[model samples]
Target: MSEPTPLQTLFDTLPQSGSVEWIGIRPARGEAMKALNNVMISRGTGLEGDRFKGRETSKRQVTLIQKEHLYVIAACLHREAISPDVFRRNIVVSGLNLLALKGKTFRIGGVVLEYTGLCHPCSKMETTLGPGGYNATRGHGGITARVVEGGELALGDNVQACS
Candidate 1:
């Protein structure tokens, strides 16, 4: 293999580690999310009880968002605050720029996940966050990932991208 370019080196560098601040799962479609301190991640599936179940190669086995983005979205929508559960993502993390994990594999506790794509806002955001909801979530919708390895993950677990 050839030497990596400067941009590749920069992209591979991630010294900051994030912490899982919250976890949630929906038992069924359109149902409210149930928050949990911890949960089991299943390979080729997703958060054990999450309503979504995609194929083994599915890019959206799990969804994660930045905790800080929640506040930003709220501010964008002119709200004092917005609960993480309302976003319907599987995990809310803080301190790490999730975008850095794009096209990389990362670990949360013992679970390993591969970044798949961006988790764009769906029309549901309109009904959930009121007017301008979808627009407010644009670019702040976080990223989607597929499980590479299954294990238990809990609130406070460290999230780090693999080298």
Candidate 2:
């Protein structure tokens, strides 16, 4: 309806492309995350067997974190390494900037997802990351998305702007 501002233009441009590095599924609330190379996504079900599958029907259907941010998050906690699992997000991607996808759709494998907003750290991080877990993940938590197209997504799958 109107011209987008420079910031909006940049946000709409997905300059970098990356692949799905890893996948995680939370089978139950407060349960340990399970790592997987592949996962099934349905319109209503977030992840086939994930605990949050049908509980949420909004942009929170799926979550993703940039793999590169893991190091930054770890540094904040003064840790040698931080497993992606600790974040509890559903997908780990590298190269592409998730923030840039807000309000836009991207395809991961055959599944399409629309970015909602930042997946800010929850109180769970306090215990998950240990002493400074919560604070370390403050800005590095990632983003949330609602499934747009249901399909299978797997490790090494290319994620790019919707064509």
Assess every candidate by TM-score: 0.97, 0.92
Per-residue CA lDDT of model 2 for 65-163, tens digit only, reads 999899998888787788899889999999988877777899999999887899999888887778888888888889988888899999999988884
For residue 17, what is the lDDT in candidate 2?
Answer: 86
lDDT of 2: 0.87
Q: Write the per-residue lDDT of candidate 1 for residues 31-142, one digit (tens) a residue.
A: 8899999999998889998888878899999999999999999999888999999899999999999999988999999899999999999999999899999999999999
lDDT of each: 0.94, 0.87
The list of candidate 1 runs beyond 4 A from truth reads none
Model 1 lDDT, full chain set: 0.94
- Go through the candidates in order and give the C-alpha RMSD of each one to the true structure: 0.8, 1.7
In candidate 2 the C-alpha lDDT for residue 144 amounts to: 88
